[model samples]
Target: MAGGLVAGYVLGKLYLLLANRLRDHTVSIVMQFVATFLVWILGEQLGLSPIITVVVYALTIARVLPLRGEAWLRVQRYAVWDVVILVLNVLAFVLIGLQLRLSLPQLEGPNGRI
Candidate 1:
């Protein structure tokens, strides 16, 4: 997990540097999406906590992106990511609720000892 976190931070910096060189808006945004998934997938494949890896990667990228002074890209990226995060949060809660519903019966187990 720690290794994945470190790798994610490094990759995040690399992504920003790469993004800086791209002239096409569509391609740059696509690259950011790809890099985000790549970091998560690679981290999980390495037996690390992918969630933590993603969080670290996102934080690193977010911190550096605004410094580049790309107003259009900044606004666009922020809007897209904000919606993504909101949806993810809603989905997480729904999934957790479903999980709880599924597990409650087992917990009740004849006498509700649990």
Candidate 2:
């Protein structure tokens, strides 16, 4: 956990630095997405919680500073990410439902241990 926190902080700072250096809005957004994956994967590989690492990195970005860009670019980013999030949400829910279905038959009647 300590390692995750420290690594998350460092990763957050790295993301901010990289974002500041990138000139293209499209590339910057893509880089941010890639950075998220990298951070999570590295955190897991280092025996840390990938979920916490990603959340910490995101909260740092959200709370520390805002990235300003062209109005058009902002709109595009919103639209794209909106769909991405929706799809992910749906997939997650579907996977949960599928898992429950697959496990239900193995469950015995009344007071069976799940």
Candidate 3:
């Protein structure tokens, strides 16, 4: 947990620094996505909560990235984030469905009853 939090903070700062140095908006957006994955995987490898790590990293970036970034970049970033949100929502629903499926047999009644 400690390692995850530290890595997340460093990752966000590194991404922000790179984004500020670079001239291309596309690269900056892509770098943010890459940093998110890196921090998430880092947290997983450290045996901690990847969600917490990613959230910290996102919160760090949220304060400045949108305000400093170009309007076009913001638009593209919004689109990308929208897709990510959709994918995560679908994945969560699928997980719930799977859990329901696993519990159904027990709920169907005991003693080999259908």
Candidate 4:
């Protein structure tokens, strides 16, 4: 856990540095997604808690970018993320509901006798 946190912090800083140095908007935007994916997967591969690692990494980016006062960079992150997440969440719940429907027979047997 501690190791995960440390690695996440360091990786996040480097990622942010590279992100900050990027002059192209398209590349910067793509890098955000790639960096997140890599951080989580890399953390897991290294036998660390990917959840903790990603959280710390995200927080580092979130907190530092604002302090750096790069309006364009910080604002672009939210441009499509919220809507995309919302749509994905809705789809996930729909799938979950369908799976639950399939398991209804096992959940209730002979008038609610589990």
Candidate 5:
């Protein structure tokens, strides 16, 4: 997780630099994928859940300081698409969980039995 976070931060910074120079969203997304791959690899090495590690790393990158005005404007322009993607991602998670029977444990009484 720590390694993922570090890699994510580095990747985000690198993306910002590249975006500034190239003015390309494709490069930014590619950098994000590279960061995610790094997180997955590091998580596997550390015996952690890769998906969870990558999600945490991605969220850390998202919440970093130094927001850009142009990025904000772009986000505003694509807010609807963002919402759609978020909903689709959530639905995918739900479906995967259901398929895997990975629901929360049923609440149990004082007996500690479900």
Candidate 6:
């Protein structure tokens, strides 16, 4: 998963560097989709979880571009709903992580002994 994420990040950065003529939004979306799809396909082929693959892809995409700063400022200026969705996504992940942790069962040795 980590390896996939690193690869995606590197690839995304390279894509951005190479595709200098494209708009930032277009580049970001294309890179994100490509990275996510590749990770998903690789994970499925390797018998790993697709959800984890997508998460790693998302992290890579986040690291590749300006999620903040000038680009973000421009986005905010035009699309407040995008920021709302981003915030909601962050909250959703936090809740999902908490729920997963909370639902974990305590482990014990065989014969019901710890």
RMSD of each: 3.0, 3.0, 2.9, 2.0, 6.2, 7.8
lDDT values for all models: 0.85, 0.81, 0.83, 0.86, 0.61, 0.59
Against the true structure, candidate 6 reaches a TM-score of 0.39
For each candidate in turn, the TM-score is: 0.72, 0.79, 0.76, 0.86, 0.44, 0.39
> Per TM-score, what order, best first?
4, 2, 3, 1, 5, 6
Candidate 2: tens digits of C-alpha lDDT, residues 5-68: 7888888987887776777878967876889899999999989999888888888776653554
With candidate 3 superimposed using the best TM-score fit, by how many Å does residue 49's alpha carbon deviate from the native?
4.1
Q: Give lDDT tens digits, candidate 6, residues 1-114.
A: 676555545555655564454456655455445655776786677666666656755565456445433666446434654665798899999999998777654555566654
**Model 2 segments more than 4 A misplaced:** 65-67, 108-114
Ranking by lDDT: 4, 1, 3, 2, 5, 6
Candidate 5: segments with Cα more than 4 A from true spot: 1-22, 72-114
Clash counts per candidate, in order, are 0, 0, 0, 0, 0, 0
Question: Model 4, 71-112: lDDT tens per residue?
Answer: 786677677578779999999999999998898778887778
Winner of 2 and 6 under lDDT: 2
Tens-place lDDT per residue, model 3, 1-110, is: 78667777877787788778867867766877777888899889988789888988888889888898888888988998899999999999999999999987877666
Q: Candidate 4, residue 61: CA error in Å?
A: 0.7
Where does candidate 4 stray beyond 4 Å? 112-114
TM-score of candidate 2 against the unseen true structure = 0.79
lDDT of 1 by residue, 4-111 (tens): 779879888888888789877778777888998999898889888899989999999889788884789878877887998999999999999999989988877567
Return whichever of 4 and 5 wins on TM-score. Answer: 4
lDDT of 2 at 93: 99
